[model samples]
Target: MRDFLPADKARRERVLAVIRERYRAHGFDEIETPVMEEHGRLHAGIGGDNEKLAYNILKRGLDAEAIRAAAEDPAQLTDLGLRYDLTVPLARFYATHRGVLPTVFRAIQIAPVWRAERPQKGRYRQFVQCDIDIIGDASDRAEAELVVATLDTLDALGLEGGIVRINDRRALDFMLDTFGFPVDERPGVLITIDKLDKIGPEGVVAELAERGAAPEAVEAFRAFLMRPQTLEFHPYGERQIRKALPEGAPDDIVAHLAGIGEAVAAARPSTGSGAT
Candidate 1:
């Protein structure tokens, strides 16, 4: 619904330049991938809710009729779809070209990704995402560096007053399982969790119930959200996580945030914390 005029486009380009420069300074290499990718790749179950929101490219030519005959499977009618995010394509790219690339590769990806969703403030079906990823580095410092570099990019753009919150997918999965949330329902549950700022905890619980989450599971998740609301921003403790999220592997998070001192020292202007 938004189109850029000459002035707008110029402004956008300048901001992108700032982002690119910061990323480059961090030793990341820029790369581009096709906007359209195989449908299977886009819906490969690794993208959580992204796979469900994939905008399918309908079948064409005589093959359309053959696919139509088996109407039960809609995937048959779609051959290609726009990528939901750069991360998936980055993984695929690394796999395909690993032989030619260095063992430790830092990456910068900036592109528009498509999603089919209800429009809301600051949320659009199509929008540009500028992402920095550290590939093939198992060390937690790589993760910390990514956050520092991204914050530096924002600082370069003169943007302030934004908090950077970090969450681990493993931790989230553990919480979901602890509450007895169905495996297939985790993705849908996550969509509501991401909206906690826009819609409060009460709203999240209601939406989860509306979406067919078990009553007990909804209650447990709601309690988990309400626990120990602290204005102070300390990386969450392992003891707190173990008692609250019994299924959680607290050691993993302890390791993940081990390099936080580097990122914290690098970007002192921003407030950061690990949240449940």
Candidate 2:
């Protein structure tokens, strides 16, 4: 097994202390949950090949009798699995603890999550996921708040050159419709386009073509994705620029962001708290 020396452990603990302090000041309550959970609920909300990566567990006693009866049955050996991400488990937790939780429950969970996958530098089969999420509100304000808080956390962590790339799934869908992509194919298209950063424009085009997208549609998608970030918001209306932001933006975007900034400033805990 891998082990960290005393000095390394102290440094890690110090970083965690800074993160906890910053998150708590912003009204995020810390909560803990089990590392292993039922696979069904985890895959229900976020369905993808990502689900297959979860580390399935086979406890000896619970399934031992069934396995013994079958002698060589593969199915009897595995049932429960490790959590893939914090979000799904958080959703299940919310549903279970709805009555006890507040109207807007802001939580910070820092825990190790396991995934069955090939690992390399910076990527691990088992790693820690630090997430702070606010649940129960369907408003865009909640999303904006979450984003801002994430930025705050990053700033606290002393990380650099980090940019919080924000995109609304709805907005992307709207853009897809605008460019004549079918609604049914939009998710696939977005998933491909999302890889634009990792893979170049040509890579995206090739993937789209492989998915049976017509050349013209693929060209159009390439054009749309390549468009410069010139989006502007005027929240109040066309005439009055609401705090010099986009018109269709959620009313609380600016306010929540400002609040996060204020909270960060008040804490003045560290230089690495803000997001890129």
Candidate 3:
């Protein structure tokens, strides 16, 4: 982590203030959660690859023999961990306080989160995250509101022309199925694909091969990935989404995202100026 001098710190706080005000204006309530959570909750499979980067806190009062006995299972030694992201803590918070909280909770969390990632430019072990979550809402309206609020916040900060890309796991699953990937292998396949930005297409194909994904499916996906790529900015809509995915894409998912785009544009007239 880097130290912020007086000027830098003041500037950062000013930006955070603007974010908080804009989010609050959108009807989101700010909530605070402990920076640490039970090690088990942090490791529960929902965290995806981030679980590995969690900074676990070792249990106290462990004797030499106890430590030796638990050596094979290191997780047994840690009772708690620094939260790698706010999502897990938010889940626990909602579960514990659901009875007292509103049926539909709109939360704004701006706090520091810790991870054990290797230090690199533009990335750090500790950093602040600004997150807005809509809990208990299953409709596409929640997505629309989130997009509108974020765009509004950016505009408030004098950073216009922000672009938001809408994607869904269902779309990924649909594409994977179209390539004949086995249902059971999709989870592992996703972990590999998450590294695509770091490993490039060839590396992804090689790793999938090493992981024993179906050869035909792997070849099909590799071919799809190797195709000539182009960047064309299209307004968020059903047509743009269809062009991005294969033919026969699920109509429901497409409509869901399209509806979100329409709702966002209706809420913020300026969103039509290439904000998607």
> Each candidate: how many clashes?
0, 16, 0
Superior by TM-score: candidate 2 or candidate 3: 3
- lDDT of prediction 2: 0.67
Candidate 3 has its poorest 10 consecutive residues by lDDT at: 267-276
Per-residue lDDT tens digits for candidate 3, residues 45-84, read 8888889899999999999999999989988999999999
Candidate 2 lDDT over 49-157, as tens digits, reads: 4576877777567655677876676545666788988877787788999899999999899998877767566667877889888877766466556655666666778
lDDT of each: 0.76, 0.67, 0.88
With candidate 2 superimposed using the best TM-score fit, by how many Å does residue 48's alpha carbon deviate from the native?
Answer: 2.9
Q: What TM-score, to 2 decimals, does candidate 3 have?
A: 0.92
lDDT of 3: 0.88
Worst 10 residues of 2 by lDDT: 233-242
What's the lDDT for residue 265 in model 1?
A: 53
lDDT (C-alpha) at residue 1 in model 1: 41
When sorted by TM-score, best at the front, the candidate numbers are 3, 1, 2
Which residue pairs in model 1 clash with each other?
none
> Model 3: runs farther than 4 Å from truth?
197-203, 228-231, 271-276
What's every prediction's RMSD, in angstroms? 3.6, 5.9, 1.9
